[model samples]
Target: MALKVLSALDVAKIQLYHFKAIIVAGMGLFTDAYDLFCIPPIIKLIGRIYYDDKSAPTAVVSNLVAIALLGTVIGQLVFGRLGDQIGRRRVYGLSLSIMVLSSIACGFSICRTRNCVLVSLGFFRFLLGVGIGGDYPLSATIMSEFANKKTRGAFIAAVFSMQGFGILASSVVTMVVSTIFDATSDAPEGHTPDEADISWRLILMLGGVPAALTYYWRMMMPETARYTALVEQNVVQAAMDMKKVLDVPMSQIAEDSPLPSSPPPTYPLLSKRFFRRHGRDLFSCAASWFLVDIVFYSSNLFQSQIYHRFIKDHDPNKNGYQLAFRVARFQAILAICSTIPGYWVTVYFIDRIGRVRIQMIGFFFMAMVYFAIGIPYKFYWHNHINDGFLVLYGLTFFFSNFGPNTTTFIVPAELFPARFRSTCHGISGAVGKVGAIIGTVGFIWASKNQKKDEKPNPERMTVALVLLGVVCLVGLSVTYFFTRETMGRSLEDNENEDDD
Candidate 1:
């Protein structure tokens, strides 16, 4: 009987509520990406602002970039469990509130000493990260539950696809701000300019705006029908909620519909039965996310450095606003060329081609491209084939979005039971953040870039690329061996709602 209400959701015609849900859920991701990716281009600006002529230390750079990710790891675990225990809607707004306050706080961060200022910013970013982290499992689970099975992949992918725009927005926002500063505020050669300090703060504060706008709409959304019926065991309320969302006739869902003889048997996330049924899926999702993030985030957070190192177009003499503007422009172009398109393509084809195939294709091609670039890096470097190298490099971003980056988020939501759905997804996402933290922090050390003014090392870059390629192979292997196709399947069927 409870399954019947779920079936209505699985086959319900797409409507305004679905789109509303996407916007509300996806805006969180937009803010998340903005808050996160905006740091890359500004890391140098930050150093110049606070640390005088000396570039920020590698440790400082790592902390500034990776601290949010660490906070995300903690947020995912705590909020994920909370979503299941409390209603998704109940706690959803709280995450956004944290994001709103903390992002603003980041911009306003000030202290008497440089260390104190950086510390205050880090603390606020960590709080902001918690809000961003909570959005992951909650949004994915909410969208997956609300979507019809036929279009579920696209819907969830759409929610995630907003991240591409967020990344682009970060670059675009930074590019514009830096460009304005470049024109208006000129410091004498070798001195930090006042505009540089203002630019980064404005960019950080603006991330909260989109999130603040969507808070009301996010609160308006009801708890997912799956959660109401399956976890809370309230069939009438579940049916009532869906009746409004789907615009179904009340006759189909009686107000006094009798409860099931017994509520669906709940599986403890760590129990033997769950391990027997879903342990591999859990591992596959977690391991694949972990591997892909290490590659994905390392490149994402340090794209500025990577471009400056690999591309010869950068002027060594350029400093202050010119450097910031150039780096921001490069990142914007990269996002437009590769990152945005890759994400939209997944939204289009995910339901058509199925998740496993898309993931495998993405991983395989990424590995191939990494090897092609890494193995012959010196040849490209020496011959000044940076253009060709960039085209190859862009493919990694393209394939990443078209591959595991999107699917890893989608699969975990679909494969787990409603009772444990958000929790498991949070666990998977948290693990992915762990990989991201490693990638972001390890990248400087791995590239052997301890000093601020150091030139790129071909040997180190080659090793990093080769190692990332190996990680891709591992992700591919895990997907092929462990993940099952969830397309065209209802949530109930995917989670074996009938079995227990």
Candidate 2:
């Protein structure tokens, strides 16, 4: 007889004890988003405070933004290798420690030169990126291994989706800091702020605390049962350990016996077969991430793109602080409010629906979003048409979180056998960062003032959208035609197929 949803639900649902696992996974993503989002506001403050010669050059600041990403590229590549070679939990623990150390350094630094600070911050950020980079594959893979098959998509998506919270909080934290500083009456004598008291330094400090707390909670977490099963080849032990972690009965676990452990003293990703099966997914994962980064990060870092437009058009006389607050609040609310429903629906249905369908739908919508953005530009070049453009942009962002991105992230973690899961996912994640690096480097290049107009050309924006549309089109094809649905499948199935 076929398994009922109720039976599957019992098999998949987490026990109260396992709630810690979800929190730990979500924390990693939260810190990643928080760290990335914090940079832009800090950049604005630095530009306002130090540069005597007008605004901070976009090229210089963009490099600072991209620098950590560069480090992330390296970290993802290296850690992906390590995660596959070592246990996922060990690597996961290491990443949290690295971030805490690096983040503290970022908070304490007292550099005066913008370049010096950039270099310093870049170094610390790179380390932070490394930690966060490692977390992507490690946490995502771990979450997939730990979660039950029926609700796997939701668990992983919920964890990944917390990134929206981090992004949302970054803006809110800045606003609150700005408000507090603005509240002070007398400049507090000799304690002048770089950009009106709540300088970029303050922003860096806020990004640090979340990761520091991560180490505290992650200790309470246990190793994934899949990892244990692979390492020890002890199915009963694996089930019992899983039972302890998830608070379930051995019979409740609904998968085949664990695959044989790879050659002793090393993890499976180090093996050749590990790469052969998952290599394409790795490259595609990285590239899609990178492509997505190009568009999103550009807009994120330079709120000047959208906020500046609003100021230039409607509120010519609007104060910078007031304008910044309004922009931050709107963006934060938009991100936070839309995420849970968007992600939860996918989680609710991932098992019933195929992974490929969800991914294709997201990619198709992603392509359309960019294509639609391009169409608007033909009608109003650099001219703000209506609220519709903003609405479309937000919906596109919604599409990103809805399924494809969330599923794209979860796929490698699930599809690859236990041995290669981390390494393969890591490499895939790195490819995404590479794409992000290109996007980051390219976005500023694309935005370069080719003319004296400096009107923040919407023409170029259209061009960028076109490129994303192309990537989305390719991603849609790759996911639809080449990818297999991993949902409800057992990890042992992958290894057996590998042997065949």
Candidate 3:
């Protein structure tokens, strides 16, 4: 039998709806980054307000960070499968609603005792994490399915790049809010109880606004033609929906036809056929993401500690507002200098240079940077050469978004069959979150053991940095051996499914 011709969606001209889809999906990612990274500074404020300590307990902070990641893992698995089983558009709005409600709950978290407050906050964050997790598979799959093959990589990269913006916004918002409160308060030394309480609540609650704004558009999105035809066996409806999105005439698709009457070969996710076809690819995606995230989440979340180490005469006596402002300022600088640009670079070149090549370059550069910083830690520290350290550190962030961070998300969404696309992406995302949990918890433990009066412990930080370099090298190897380049190829061509 001859292969069926391309459908309207596969060959559709790039149009305004493509950009709109990117924004609707991209905003969810923006919310994810803001909600996740914003917590670090607020956690510091929570400590000052509730416990009267400069930082929260190591165990408490670790839990606060890891619990949301845990929720994300579960949410990804559940929502990813549901997307395939039901439909992408049907389940898309549900996650945003979860985020809106949870963010509000987190902001309003209150209790009579410190422990109760912490517990309530963690609970809400976990729920928020679940919502954030759902966005991963849904947005990635939706964007990929909607995009034209010629520019799919760039479109997806554009969606992922919103994360950098989200991170930037978190820092900017924190700085602005803290500045306003500090200027108004009459308290000379530190944040008053009321000031600290109100500030943290406002920061958290603001995360919900973006997610809520995107909800109407998310509901209006039609199910992907690929999902409708392949999974639901509704080729006519799929054609109509694709016509709406692509703005092509129905006559253009009249010659195109449904898939074969004979069913495609079925393989359970854990079965041998599945492994033979996709096992290595899945392992490659999951493992590379796991490795990158260990450094990515830990380094980004613990920037406060890194900034404090950089500045000499770092007063142990600074007030809460002072500490929060400085951290936000430094982070904002890093985001502007390297983080945001890295994401856009990938968007510009992903289709031209290909995903695997870009990822390889990113990992190789990241490994080199980590080694440079780790081996010279003592020299950099003792000589107070923080400017040098900061440049190298910022380079790592640059390459990370430009490299494995973006590729990991893109590969899983593209490589798998539609039946399993969302599930596989979810699984890949969940694995990455597991690495995030380990990294966050491990860093807290490592940092806590260092003596208070000593200069930042170069020896201990050296070990962590070197380990990150090794992990990047491992990720590079996996990308070389297992992952395939997906640029300029239709989803049907990549999967080789019969279109009848």
Per-residue alpha-carbon lDDT of candidate 1 for residues 326-404, written as tens digits (9 for 90 to 100) = 6667777888999899999999999999999999999999999988877776556424545776788789999999999
Cα lDDT of model 3 by residue, 479-500, tens digit = 8998888888778764564432
Instruction: List TM-score per model, in order.
Output: 0.94, 0.86, 0.94
Candidate 1, lDDT over the whole model: 0.82
**What's the count of clashing pairs in each model shown?**
0, 5, 0
lDDT of the candidates, in the order given: 0.82, 0.65, 0.81
Cα lDDT over the full model 3: 0.81
Q: What's the distance in Å from true for residue 11, model 3?
A: 2.5
Error of 2 at 51 (Å): 2.0
Best-to-worst order by lDDT is 1, 3, 2
Q: Output the number of the lDDT-best candidate.
A: 1
Could you give the C-alpha RMSD of every candidate to the true structure, in order shown?
2.4, 4.5, 2.5
